[model samples]
Target: MNKIEIIARRILGWKLNRWDRWYDFEKEQFIPVSEFQPEENIEHAMLIVERLKELGFSYKTNGTSGACFGDVCETGETLAQAITNAAYSVADNSSIDEGWL
Candidate 1:
């Protein structure tokens, strides 16, 4: 697996169920609550969410779920692929050294 795939699976708790979605511990369910949403940009948003959590920031979906259709990329990659790419980008751009961990 690529670096992004590792991060998404190990850090973000993404599950592969036809596509990819984050597991919500509070709700004991997945967000977006849909088997498919052609326009959702969940992949990238999930990464951002995890980063915020790491920074001691908190958030709630507030009963709202789903991403904007406009956020979807034209590359035709699945949600999982998108998330993997996002993770790789983050890891590549991060200033923090992995050796610290």
Candidate 2:
């Protein structure tokens, strides 16, 4: 893994600022809500999911050809809860609490 990934593994996870608040594991950095999905492609979604997985997050969602809706966790909570927390943090521009990771 890379430095950021290493950082990510060390209780230093990130939550993207994007709509989904997708965390970047490789960089252990947040992307911000603006970078989410203007196009909303599966490739991008999967990319985000991959990063989340590195953070030990998991998800499973059905698709109608190419979309999904599922969970992201290992944090002992629902993905929605995680996202809400993320959104709140983003709204507040607060520092990341890797401790929660």
Candidate 3:
């Protein structure tokens, strides 16, 4: 496996599956949120957020009442796009190439 896949599988504990789904490490099987715990889902999401931060991404909240979101440093990008770019960076060991943000 490439470094990206290795890091994703070993550190993030995720495996891409068909139908836009991912394997849940805690569950030991491939399934959707409908079969998982809410807390686990939050934990997994936080993991990605943390990783993105490590890759120089930033996040903000609406003063504890607004929705939480992330953005690229010095750029306006959606949280989802930031996360995807960061993951690709980790996998490829290269800087983010997406220009959306």
Candidate 4:
């Protein structure tokens, strides 16, 4: 899986359902949440930020250099890349259910 997917399923504890999907306001169309790439879509990316907030963490990005969550900070060329990388920094991907362990 990709970085955003890993962050969603592993770090965010997302369990997929058949009905999993979302509406893209920007594109004005429906899309599968399972296929949502938060790094490329700002709205969906905000959802990740909100989820992180609910999880008792805060995020900050310079929009050009990097983003940070708690004590971990990661740098990237773009804001989206930076945020995604930072979020993925906390992912525990060694789970048997995810088939990576």
Identify the leading candidate in terms of TM-score. 4
lDDT of 2 by residue, 1-101 (tens): 33223322333345434444547565666654445431333443454445445655544533232222133222213443333333223223236455544
Tens-place lDDT per residue, model 3, 1-101, is 64334445544566767544568666677755344221224344456557555656565543222223343221114443334344444444445453321
Q: lDDT values of the candidates?
A: 0.43, 0.38, 0.45, 0.65
**If the candidates were sorted by their lDDT against the true structure, best first, what order would they fall in?**
4, 3, 1, 2
Query: What lDDT score is found at residue 71 in candidate 1?
Result: 27
- Measured against the true structure, the TM-scores of the candidates, in listed sequence, are 0.29, 0.32, 0.35, 0.65
RMSD of each: 9.5, 10.8, 8.7, 6.4
Instruction: Report the candidate with higher lDDT, 1 versus 4.
Output: 4
lDDT of 1 by residue, 1-101 (tens): 55644444444555543345546453476744243222245645565556535744343432233212222221224544443343444444456454421
Q: Which ten residues in a row have the lowest lDDT in candidate 2?
A: 67-76
Cα error, residue 100 of model 3, in Å, equals: 28
Steric clash count of candidate 4: 0
State, as a TM-score between 0 and 1, how close model 3 is to the true structure: 0.35
